[model samples]
Target: MTSPFDFDRELAELGAAHLLRRRRQVAPLVPPMDLQPDQEHLRGTTYLIDGQERLSFGSNDYLGLSQHPAVIAAAQQAAARYGVGATASPLVCGHSPAHESLEHELAALVGLPRALYFYAGYAANVGIVPALVGKGDAIFSDALNHACLIDGARLSRADIYVLPHRDLAALEAQLQASEAPRKLVITDAVFSMDGTVADVPALLALCERHDAWLLIDDAHGFGVLGAQGEGTLAHFGIVGQGGVAPEWQGRLGRLVYMATLGKAAGVSGAFVAGEPAVIEWIMQKARTYMFATGAPPMVAEALRAAVQLILAEPWRRQHLQALQRQLREGLQAAGVPWDLWPSDTAIQPLVIGRNESALKVMAALDRQGVWVPAIRPPTVPKGSARLRISLSAAHTGEHVARLVEALRQAA
Candidate 1:
């Protein structure tokens, strides 16, 4: 007879392995009694966990635009004007002026001919991959790519080769060996867990030599990298104020770029920008975009305001970089046992190696009123569990200093 399902036993095994996960209920900052009434109205950077306020270092609100007055106001206005939901799929009656305008703005921001919006970053990857290639095609992906990209490659029914993380030689070899009719190279512009950026220009070169399509998921780089916040492409000097480099400008047709709004943009939803024809193809064939109810029009409006803020305020990115530098330098000075993964970005990961050790450090930090989440497998490779410290522009220097001191005491 077939064995009966045993969730209890499986859960017990996971617990014994120290890989089980739990969620904590958290409330955004509540003002202290000593603060004035006007100051009380201002949101703080701490979170209340288990009835204790803790300084948060585990959020992905990199630019801290999530609580911006303009973004919130725009959302309110759109909700009043358009209501709460789209109520239909994009292909049906769901498309709105807000969505269209956001799409146009995103394409321009990313220096692409057209763009297609999705409900989330995961949806964009899962949907776009299959829409582009399948069956006889081949997909070259990075070993440490986001789960969504891995899932997308699997779902495509294509020949999948996962190259070692950031190994350009391996990637090139795979690309060269593939004889499939359509070849696509997909990678994250920033590896989320390790917090290191990919060499996009080099990847583009390989793709060009191999005559393969290059898709870069710049979710982490979008609002934080470029001078004008144009994302990884701009950071590489491939595209700038004038436009894409002349030599590579014509190759834009084969390049696909995606960025999610929830991270740096401080909103929800994601967009894929590329050649007009590629977007048109995705619109018709991407099932996730076709079958799912469209994202709320209000969200699209809020995202438009977010894009404007990203472009208008360069100081947000500057302040964020300063905070990152402060945290890194402070940690080094404190001589903490755990070293952060080499990353100049806002995502500074302190690898704790073993799962139990990571959990212990996380708990210790919690006791000291610092909230940094312990990230474990299968989010990262086994034996490399870490404390993922996601810095935000809103974080003060004093906050960073406090966290450093907390680390010293906790250690």
Candidate 2:
């Protein structure tokens, strides 16, 4: 039977390469909260369970609302009112008032004509792309776009031109030679691994000149950027540019934005805001939305509350920026080798040259009661493994200091 597929050889090679991942089970915490003396797991922002403490500097809960009282209360109320599951797809009997309300709120938040909800960020990207662009069309994608975007583009059956990361000139050259009537340019607002913001203004400028459609996945930027957290478009002054804010009924001119509620918003869903036609087409044709079961009513309620909190609280973003600056300054003072990551947001990484070195440093930090994960190859480029250090507003000055200390020791 083909020599039993040689599973042992592959496993051995993966172990040798330091690419094997394992899950650590943790016991639940008791009162007078503390991490387990020899900790085994994590809960929310902190990395502890019983009586020990582990400073956590690696989480995407930017606003620390994942366990917020309001969000929990809202979800509980929703579960009571609408039950536990959606039970069907949106086109069936699953679309509830909660989903509809969130859509309206998101559309208003992003200044768009309409918005559609998806169960996951990957599903949102996958559904939106192929539904809009197809056989005779082409999608110009960034080389560093997330795996979800890459999968979605691949599924589109359209020619994909992967321009070099942030290379606007290369993109222009590709567009200049394009002959497709429906050319869509897809990019991430902030790259996941590098924590770098896209050159959106320049990209939008090029889109205007080329007369192409622009789609921005703001999964990493939402609730952490802009005046009121309208994401990258607002952060770069492109949405309300030149004293012209595109109203609900504005023409399908250029920009289309998609954001996920799981990170900064501290919820469990994703949404896309764009021209009415584009969203409507996704509703009708996108297989994920049409065939898959909709998100639970409870999640929709939680996201609604999360959006309100994002608008109501501005200090969270401010605290995050301050924390980022503190960490950067501390690292500098200690003479640590690192990169700025081209972002002022929560996601950050310290490049470590070798995979084994990265794993060893992460293990050392974990032993010293610090929990930061090592991001290795496949997630990043070869020879570019790093410790992906994420910051959250829930962290205090002491937390940052402890992280600096842990990094020093690990190094």
Clash total of candidate 2? 3
The RMSD of every model to the true structure, in order and in angstroms, is 2.2, 3.8
Worst 10 residues of 2 by lDDT: 26-35
What is the per-residue lDDT of model 2 for residues 1-411, given as tens digits with 9 covering 90 to 100? 546689888888889998887775433232213435443223355645234566677667888777676888899999999999999999999999999999999888876778999999999899889988998898999988998889999999999999889899999999999999889999999988888899887887788888888888999898888877778877876553232254412434577789988999888879988778778877999888899999999999999998998889989899989999998888878776645455577888888868998898898888888888898878888898888998988777778888888888766
lDDT score for residue 330 of model 1? 93
Q: In terms of TM-score, which candidate is strongest?
A: 1
Residue-level lDDT of model 1, residues 1-411, one tens digit each, is: 534687888888999999998878877765333345554322436778778888888878898887777888899999999999999999999999999999999988877889999999999999999999999999999999998899998999999998899999999888888899999999999889888999998988888899999888998999999988889999888887666878677877788999999999988989999888999999999889999999999999999999999999999899989988998899999998996889988889999899999999999999998999999999999989999999888788888998999888878
Off by over 4 Å in 2: 1-4, 26-43, 49-53, 240-252, 338-340
Q: Give the TM-score (vs. native) of candidate 2.
A: 0.92
Best by lDDT: 1
- Tell me the spans in candidate 1 whose CA falls farther than 4 Å from its real position: 1-4, 31-44
